[model samples]
Target: MVNIALGASLSTVILTVPVMEAISLYTGQPFIMAMTSVQTVMVTITLIVAAINLNDGQTNAIEGMTHFVLFATFVMLTVLGL
Candidate 1:
């Protein structure tokens, strides 16, 4: 399940980028494809934590909560532009 989730997440990003870029071209709006340093760091940390959590091939509510917290952190950081 974790592997599926990870694959889906990555697929979403990979698939969305070009579509977004195409839309931007059609609309004459520049697509901001760059990530801030903080955003990049957050992504790296999130992936690392996810890998560690899934290493044992078992998970519980605590792991889910941890993921939720990390997601919340990502949202907060994005909103704050930090």
Candidate 2:
């Protein structure tokens, strides 16, 4: 599962960025290939938290709750930030 997640993320970055940039350029729009500081920090924190939680390669109620809380935080941040 972890390998699949990593592969999908890697492929998305490898494949999407260039295609997005090309389309942006073709459309005469600036391709802002960057995330906001909040987004970057949040993503970094999420990855760190996920790594810590998944280190034992097991999931439980606590893990699920933590993930749900994190996801809720993400949605709130996105909605409120905009």
Question: Which tens-of-lDDT digit does each residue in 8-67 have in candidate 1?
Answer: 988888988888988999999999858999989888988898898999999889988988
lDDT of model 1, residue 50 = 88
Error of 1 at 27 (Å): 21
Candidate 2 lDDT at 30 equals: 97
lDDT of 2 by residue, 1-82 (tens): 9899989999898999889988998999998847778877778888888999999998899887988888888888888983
Model 1 regions lying over 4 Å from their true place: 1-10, 13-32
**In candidate 2, where is summed lDDT lowest over 10 consecutive residues?**
33-42
Cα RMSD (angstroms) for every candidate in the order listed: 4.7, 4.5
TM-score of candidate 1 relative to the true fold? 0.64
State the local distance difference test value for candidate 2: 0.86
